[model samples]
Target chain A: MAKNLVIPIGPQHPSLKEPACFTITLEGEKVVNAVVGTGYNHRGLEKACEARTFIQDLYIIERVCGICSHIHSTTFCQAVEELAGVEITRRAAYIRTIMAELERLHSHLLWLGIAGHEVGFDTLLMYSWRDRELVLDVLAALGGNRVNYGINTIGGVRRDVTPELIEQIRKVADIVEERNKYYIQLALSETTLAARLGGIGKLSHDDAIKFGAVGPVSRAAEVPDDIRVTDPYAAYDEVPVTAITDNHADVFGRTVVRVLEIMESVKMIRFCLDNLPEGDIVTKVPRKIPEGEVLIRTEAPRGEDAHYVRSNGTDKPDRVRVRAASEANWHGMKHMLEGDYLADVPIIIAAIDPCYSCTDRAIILDNHDTGEQSVTDWRSLREYSINWYKVRGIDTSKIKIAYSPLIF
Target chain B: MSELIAEKQALATILEKFPFLEGKLEIQRRQRIISSALERPLFEEVFGFVTTDGGFDNFHLVIGVDDGDNLGFIYVLSNDDKVMLSLKQSAPKSNPAIKSVCSVFPNALWHERELVDLFGAIVEELPEGPTYPLPDGWPAGNYPLRKEWKVEYFDKVNMTYNPPVTAGKEEE
Candidate 1:
C-alpha cells in the first residue's frame, strides 16, 4: 500500500533566500502536485511610485530588487525620457550599457553561487561568491555603491566612470575572468554535480517558447529571445550581443548559458571601456514632462525589465507600470515541478533565478463559502500553536522551566 | 539594419497603415517614441506591423500609463533586425477599459494586470480571478494611481486592515 504525503518547502528554507512557500504533494518520493505561495515581503512599489516625482521615482524603482537595480532604474528613466522628449547623450548611453552589463556580471555570479549551494556544492558556492565580490567592488568604484547604484536618471547617468575607474574595471575584469574560469571548471567537472543537474528540470524549446520564457531561461531551451540583441538599448547596439543557447533546457543547461553569458558580458564591458565614447555623460532634462506615454524595455540580469511611464505635463507621473521578468517565468513552475522528486524542487526554482520581491507581494486567500479564508498572518500561526497545545491537553500550570541569564 | 533606420522604417510602416497615425506617432531615437489616441484597433494595427514585418520580432514590454482624465498604454516591441517600436494606446479617463490582447500574445496577462493595478483600466475578457497587489478589502472605488489619490498614512494603515471573521469549525 502506498500513502500520500504532503511536504512544505520554504517560506523559510535555507536553499531559498526569498520568502515563498511551495507545498508539494508526494506519492512516495515523486512529487505529484505543487502549489506555490508568496507575499511574505510586499513593499507595494508600483503604488508608491505614484506619490514620487519623476526624478524621485528612480530612487524608488532601484529598490524594487537589489540585484537588478540599475536596469530597473534605467528602464524607468528611459521611459520617462522618451515621454519628455529628452535625448540622452551617446556617451551616457554607452555608460548605461556598461553599467547594465556589469550588473549582469554580478547578478549571474550571484545566481551561480546560489545554484551551487542548491546542488550541495558549498566549495563552488564560496568560490563563485568570492569572485562575485570583485565585480561588486568594480561597481562600487564606478557607481559609488555596491547594490543600488544611483547612476541612472531621466536624461542620462548621474555619475560618469572616471579614467581611474575605467582602469579599475579592466583590471578587475581580468582577475574575474581567471577566477571565473576556475569556478566554471569546477561546476562543469565532477560527475556528481553534473549528474544531479544535467538532465533535471528539463524544459523543451517548444514549451519554453509557448510559455514566453525570456533571458537565459528561454535561451537555455534553445530560443534566442535576448532583448539586448532584439532591442538594442543603451550601448548594446554598439557592442554586438552574442546570445548563448543550449538545446537542453535542464538546470545544468541554464547554468552553462548563464556562465557563458557572463563571459560575453565581460567581453562587452571590455569592448565598451576600450572604445568608450568621448562626450558628456548627461543631457539636461526638463522639469515638466509633456503629455505622452512611452514603453521601455532593457535586459535586466534575470531577464527583460520593462517600464511604462505616462506624463501629463507634471513632475509626478500619472501612472507607471512595471512588468518584471520573473512574473513571466513563473508560469513554467508547474511544468518544471511535474515528475520531479521533492529534493529537486529547490534546484528547479533556483534555475529560473526568480526575484519574488519584484514580482509579487504577500499572498492573502479568503474562502467565501465558509467565510474562513481571511488573511492568514503570523498571529494566526500563534493561535494555531495555542490550539495545538490545548488539543494535547498540556497542563501548563504544572510545568515550570527555569530561565537562565545571558552568559555574556 | 541600424537602430535609427529600423526605427524610422517601422514608424513609416505604421503611418502608412493608418495615415492618421503619422502626426500622432513621434520617434525620439533608435528605439524610443510616443503615440497618441491609443485604442484596441490601434494595438492590433501595431501588432500587425510586428508579426507581418520581418524586422520587428518580439514584444519586450507593455506599460499602462494613466493620465488624470485619460488612460494611455505603451507597448515596447523589438525585432532581431534592430528595430524597436514603442506603440501607444489610450482610453477615456471616465471609462478606462479596453479590449484584451491575450489572444494575440498570452504574455499580456501580467502586463494587463499591471495596467489594471496602476491605471485602473479594465481589460475586457481579463481572466476571471482574484485581484493581485491590492488587498481583498481595498476600497472598491479607490484607484491609487489617479493624481487625485493623495498619499496619506491612513491608506497604509487600511492596507493592513483586514476585518476579522469567525474561524469555521470542521463540524457544525
Candidate 2:
C-alpha cells in the first residue's frame, strides 16, 4: 500500500491570483483528496458597502475585480436601481450589454492565455495575450480606462458609446474573430494540449449539475447554465445568447466552451452596437434608496456572478452579500482533481479559470498571526517542489524550465 | 396564456400545493418575486417543498445578514423563468444556529461556511474544517461581516476593530 503524503499548495501559488491554500493528500502521485483554504485576500468589500452611500459603492464594487469590474458594478447598480424604482434608459441598457460582452471577451482571452502558459504552451499564451490587448484598447476607448472602467452608475452607464467608438469596436471585433477562429482550431488540434488536457480533469455531467456549477465550467459539462440566456438582464433580452455547450466534461471541454463563448461575445457586441437605441444614457436617481432587498445576477466571463443587497431606507446599504461564480465553482475542483496526477494540478485549476482575487474580494482581512504565517511566494513554492523531489532521492537537475511570463 | 400569466401560474402552483405556506409566501406583484420570511425551524421543510414540488432547481444564493438582534438568512432559489423565491429565516443573536441546507442544495455548503466564518451564524450539522474564506489562526470571535465590526487604520495598517461598547459577545 502506498503511504499517504500531504502537499499544501498556495495561499500564494503562481496559478492562484489571490491567496488560497489547497491541501492535496496524495497516495503516491495520484491525489486521494484535496481541501481548499482561502480568505487571504478578503478586503471586506461587502462590509465596506455598508459605510458608503449608493453612489460611492459603484466604485468600491468595481474594484472587486480588475477583470470583471464592470459586471460587479453593473450588478450592484441593477440591485440598487430596483430598490430605488429607477428605470434606466433603453440606450443605457444596450450600452451596458456592449461593455459587459466586451469585458467577457477580454476576460476569456486572458484566461486562454493563462491556461496556455499553465500547460507549457507559451506560444498560445503570447498570441492570446497580444490579441487580448485589442479588446482592452476598445474598453479603454469606451470607458476611458483599460481596467476597472468605472462606467456603471446607479441607474445607467456613466459613459456613452459613440458612433466612432462603435466603428472602432467593429474593426477590433473583425480582427478578434479571425484570431479566435485560429485559437479554436489550435486549442482543438494542438498535440501537446491534447495530451495534457484531453480527458485530464473529467467531471461527469451529473456532478456538474449536482454541484451547481455555473457559467462556462458547467456549460462545458453540457449543463447549458448560462445566466445571459436563462435570466436575461441588461440588453441580453434584446440581443440574446445561444449558450454554447460541450459534452466533453474535462479541461478540453472548458477550453472549447470558453473559446466559443468568446466568439459569441464578439457577435453579441456587434449586435448591440448595430441595434443600440437612441435616448439619454443616465437616469436621475435619489441620493437615498428605499427600504427593500433585491438579487441581481450577471453573467461574468468566469460564471454567474450575483449580488444580494438590502437597504434600510438610507443612503447606504444595510448589507451587501456577493456570490462570485468562482465561489460556486470552487467546490467542483475537488471532484475533478481527485485521482489526477500532481503535475496536472496547475492546468486543472486554470481550466476553471479560477479568479481567487475576485472570489475573495469581500473576504480579505488582516492577518494578525504574523509569527506563525510562513509566506511561500511562487519562487519558493517551485524551489520547495524541486527540493522535495531531491529529498526523495530523485535527481531534478535534468528538468528543463520553460519560460512563461507571470501575467497574474 | 401570456408570459406574465404563465409565470404567475407557475408560482401559484407552489403556494397552492403547500397550503401551510399561504401567509408566509408573498408574491412581489410587480416583479413576480415569490419571497417569504419564516421561522428558523421551517427552512428545511419549506425549501424541500420548493425544490421537489415547487419545480425550482436553481439555487441562486444564500445571504447571511447581521440584523442586530438576529442573524437573518435569505435562501434565494429559482425555477428558470417561473419565479425567483427568497426564503428568509433568522436565528436569535443569543443563539445563532440554523439547520444546514447542504442536503437540500449541495452548493449551500459554501454559503453555510461563509455564514459560520463571517456572520458567526452556527449552522447545525456543518462539517468541521478550517475557517473558510478566512485564514487559519485568524483571531477567534472576530466575525468581520457582523454589523458592529469595523476596520480601523492606524499608521496605514488596517486592523479589525470593534468599539469597546460592542466587544466580548460570544458569537458561538
Candidate 3:
C-alpha cells in the first residue's frame, strides 16, 4: 500500500485565473481525494445590496459577475418588479431578452476560450476570444460598456434597442453563428478532443442530479433542467429557445453544449431583431416595493442564476440572496475531480466555469487572524510582492508605487 | 388549460402527495412560483419526501434570512421543466438552527456552510467544511447579515495601523 500525497493547487496559481484552493490527495498520478476551498475573494455583496436602495443595488448587483452582469441585474429587477406588481411592456421584455442572449453569447465564448486554454488548445482559445469581441462590441454599442452593461432598470431597460443597434447585433450574431458552427463541427468530429476529454471528469446523470450540478455541467450529463425553458423570463417565453444537452458527461460534453448553445443564442438574437417590437421601453414602477418576497430564476450562460428579494415596503430590501450558477456547480466538483489524473484538474474546474468573485459574497478581511502582520496597506502589499518576486528571480523592485489608505 | 388551472393543479398535486403541505402552500399565477411554509422540525421530512416520493429532485438553492426575532430559510426546489417551489422555515434568533439535508441533497451542505458564516445558522450534522465565502481565520461571533450586525462590530480590526499621510483623505 502507498501513502497518499497531498498537493495544494492555489488561491493563486498559473492554471486557475481566479482565487480558489483545491487540495488534492493523490496516489501517484491519480487523485484519490479532492477538497475545493474558496473564500479569498468574499466581498459581502449581498450585505451591501441590503443596505442600499433598489436603484442603488442595481449597480451593485449588476457588478456581481463581470461576465454575466445583465443576468444578475435582470434577476434583481424582475424580483423587485414582481413585488411591486408592475408589468413591463412587450418591447421591454424583448429588449431584455436580446440583452440576456447577447450576454450568453459573450459568456459562452469566453468559457470556450478558457476551456481551450485549459486543454492546451491555444488555437481554439485564440479563435473563440477573437469571435467573442464581436458580441462584446454589440453589447458595448447598446449599453456604452463592453462589460457591466447597465441596460436593465427596475420596470424596464434604460436604453432602447435602436435600429442601428439592432442591425449591428444582427451582423455580430451572424458572424458568431457561422464561427460556432465550425466549433461545433470541430467538437463533434475532432478525434483528439474526444480522446483527451471524452472520459475525463465523467459525471454520471444520476450523480449530476445527486450533487445538484447546474448549467452546462449538468446539461452535459444529459440533465435538461434549463431555467430559460423551465421558468421563462423576459422575452424567453416568446423567443424560440431550446435547452442544449449532451450525453458525454465529461468536459467534452460541456464544450459541445456551450458551442451548440451559442448557435441557439444567435438564432434567438436574429429572431428578436427581425421581429423587433415598438413601444415604450421603461415603465413607471414604484421606488418602494411592497412588503413581500419574490424569487427570480434566470438562465445565465453558465447555469441557473437565482435571486431572492424580500422587501419590507421600504425603499431598501430586507434581504437579497444570490445563488450564482457556480456555487451549485461547486458542490459537484469533488465528485468530478476524484478518480482522475491530477493533470486533468484544471479543465474539470474550467468545465464548470467557476467565478470566484461572484460566489464569495460573505466577507473578505479576516478580522481575527491576530498577532500576524498581514496586508495592512497598499505600500506593504507592494513591498511584500517585490520581495516575493525578487526571491523568484523576477525583479519587480524597479516599479515605484505610491502609498494609499485601505479602501474599506 | 388556463395558466391558473395549471397552477392550481400543480399545487393540488403536491398537497395530495404530502398531507403535511396542504395548509401551507399557495401558488402565484403568471409567475408559476409556489411558496410553502413548514415548521423547522418538518424541514428534514419535507426534504426527504420531495426528493424521493414527492417528485421534486432538483434542489436549486437554500436562502437563510435574518428577520429580527427569527431567522427565515427558503429552499428553492424544482422538478425538471416543472414549477418552482420555495419551501420556507424559520427558527428563533437565539438558536437559528437548521437540520442539514446534505444526506439527501448533497448541495445543501455548501448553502448550509454559508448560513453558518453570514447568518450564524447552526445546522445539525453540517459535515465539516470551510467557512465558505468568508476568509479563513475570520473572527467568530460576528454574523454580518443580521439586522443588528454592523461593520462597526469589527472596529477592533479596522482601527489598527494608521494609513500614510497620502491616503483617501489626502487632497489631490
Candidate 4:
C-alpha cells in the first residue's frame, strides 16, 4: 500500500522564517507534489506607490525588501531619472555602481551565513556574518545607514564620495574579496556539503530558462541570465562585470555561483573606486515628470530586480510596479521542492536565499480535493494545524511560540 | 546585438507583421529597451512570435496597470543580449480580460495569478487555482488594485478592517 501523507510546511512553520506555506504531499520520505503559497505580509506597495508623490514613494519603495533596499530604490530612481530625462553625473553613476556592488557583497555574505546555518555549518555562519559587517560599515559611511540606504534620489544619488572614501572602500572590499575566495573553495570542494546538497534541489538549465529563473539560481543551472551583464546599468558598462555561472544546477551550484559572484562584486567595487570619476553627485530635474512609462532593471544580489514607472505628467506617478527579484524566483520553487526528500526541505527553501514579501496564503487543489479549499488566516490555520496533530495523537499544545503570544 | 536582435529589426518586424502597431512601437537604443502596444486579440500571436522566432524568449515579468477606462498589461521579455521588449496590451475596463501566455512562457503562471487577484483582470486560461498575492475566500468581486478602490474603502471590507489575523481565532 502506498501511503500518501499531505503535509503543510508553513504559513507559521517554525523551521521556515518566510511567511510562505508549501503544501507537500509525501510518499514515505519522498515528496510527490508541492504547491508554493506566499503573500502573508502584503503591504500593498505598488498601489501605495501610485497614490503618493514621487519623493514620498522613494521611501515606500525602499521598504520593499530589507536586504536589497538600495537595489530597489536605485532601480526606481533610475526609472524616474530616465523619464525625467536627467542624465546623472559620471561620479554619481560610479557611486551608485559602487554602492550596488557593496550591496551585493553584503547580501551574498548574508546568504552564505544563512546557508551555513541551515546546513549546520555554524562556523561558516559566524565567520561570514562577522565579515559582512565590514561591507555594511562601508555602506554606513557612504549612505549614513546600514539598511535602506537613502543614497538614491530622483536626479541622482544624495551622497557624494571623496577620493579618501574610495580608498577606504577598496581596502574593505579587498579584505572581503580574499575571504570569499576561501569560501568559494570551501563551498565547491567540501565533501560533506557535496553529498548533502549536490542533487537535492535540482533545477536543470532547460527548466531554469523555461521557468525564467534569475540571478544565482539560474546561473547555477548554467542559464547565464544576469541583468547586470546583459544590460549594463549604473557603472557596469564602465566597470566590467563577469556573470559567474555554474553547471551544478542544484543547491551546491547556487552556493558556488553566489560565493564566486561575491568575488565579482569585490572586483567591480575595486574598479569603481580606482577609476572614481569626479563631478557633482546629482543633476537638477523637474518635479513634474513628463508623461511617459519606463521599465528599469538592476541585478539585485538575489536576482533581476525590475521597476516600471508610468507617469501622467504629474507630481505623482500614474503607476509604479516593483517586480522584486524574489517574485520571479518563486515560480521555480514548486519544481525544485517536488521529488526531494522531506528532510532536505529546509535547506532547499533556504538555498534560494528567499527574501519573502508579506502578501497572502493559498491552498492549491490538484484533482485530489481534500475539502480544504479555503483562504485561511494565521489564527484559524494555526488552530487547524494544532488540532490536526492532536487528532493524529501528537500533542504540540505545549509549544510556546513567542511571536504569537495570543496563541493560547 | 545579433542579426535577429539588431535594434531596428526587432522593433520593425512586429510593426511590419502587425501594421496597426506602426505608430505604437518604440525602441530606446541607449537603454536597449523596446515597447509595442498591441490589441488584446493580437497579444498571443505577437508574444508567441517574439518568444519563438524573435529570440527574446526570457519571460521576465508581467505588469498589470489600471488605466482610467481600461486595464493594461505589459509583458516584459528579454534575450541573451539583454534586449527587453515590453509587449503592451489592454482590455476595456468593462470587460477587463486578457489571454494567458503561460503556454508559451511557463513562468507566467504566478504573474498572471497576481493580475487576477489585485486588478481582477480576468486572465483567460489562467489555470484554475488558488488566488495569488491575495488570501483565499477574499471577496470575489473586489479587485484592490483598481484606481476606484481607495485605501479608505479597505476599512469597510473585512479584507482591511478585520482585526489582525495573528490574533487567536478563539477571541472571535
lDDT of 2 by residue, B63-149 (tens): 988888888888877775636677788788778888887876777787888888888888898877776666565666677787756
For residue B135, give model 1's deviation from the true position in Å.
3.9
A258-289 in candidate 1: lDDT tens per residue? Answer: 88888888899999998888999888888888
Candidates ranked by DockQ, best first? 3, 4, 2, 1
Give the least accurate 10-residue stretch of model 1 chain A, judged by summed lDDT: A399-408
Question: What stretches of model 2 exceed 4 Å from their correct place?
Answer: A356-408, B1-6, B29-32, B80-82, B152-162, B165-172
Which of the two candidates, 2 or 3, achieves a greater DockQ against the reference? 3
Give one digit per residue, the lDDT tens place, for model 1 in B58-151: 5555666555477766666565554556667778877887877666566566667656765578789887644555555666556666655544
RMSD per candidate (Å) reads 12.2, 8.6, 10.2, 11.9
| C-alpha lDDT (0 to 100) for residue A351 of candidate 1 | 94
State what share of the real interface contacts each candidate retains: 0.30, 0.68, 0.92, 0.84
* TM-score of candidate 3 relative to the true fold: 0.86
Q: For all the predictions, what are the DockQ values?
A: 0.23, 0.49, 0.55, 0.54
Q: Please list the residue runs of candidate 4 whose C-alpha ends up more than 4 Å from where it truly belongs after superposition.
A: A356-408, B1-5, B31-36, B160-172
Chain A TM-score values for every predicted structure, listed in order: 0.85, 0.86, 0.87, 0.86
Clashing residue pairs found in predicted model 4:
A39-A359, A39-A360, A40-A359, A40-A360, A41-A358, A41-A359, A42-A358, A42-A359, A375-B136
Comparing candidate 2 with candidate 4, which one achieves the higher lDDT?
4
List, residue by residue over B72-159, the lDDT tens digit for candidate 3: 8888877643767688888898888788878878888878888888888888898986778776566666677887665543554543
Q: After superposition, how far is residue A205 of candidate 2 from its true place, in Å?
A: 1.6
lDDT of each: 0.74, 0.81, 0.82, 0.82
How displaced is residue A46 in candidate 2, in Å? 0.6
For model 1 the interface RMSD, in Å, equals 3.3
| Candidate that beats the other on TM-score, 1 or 3, i.e. the better one | 3
User: What is the C-alpha local distance difference test score of candidate 3?
Assistant: 0.82
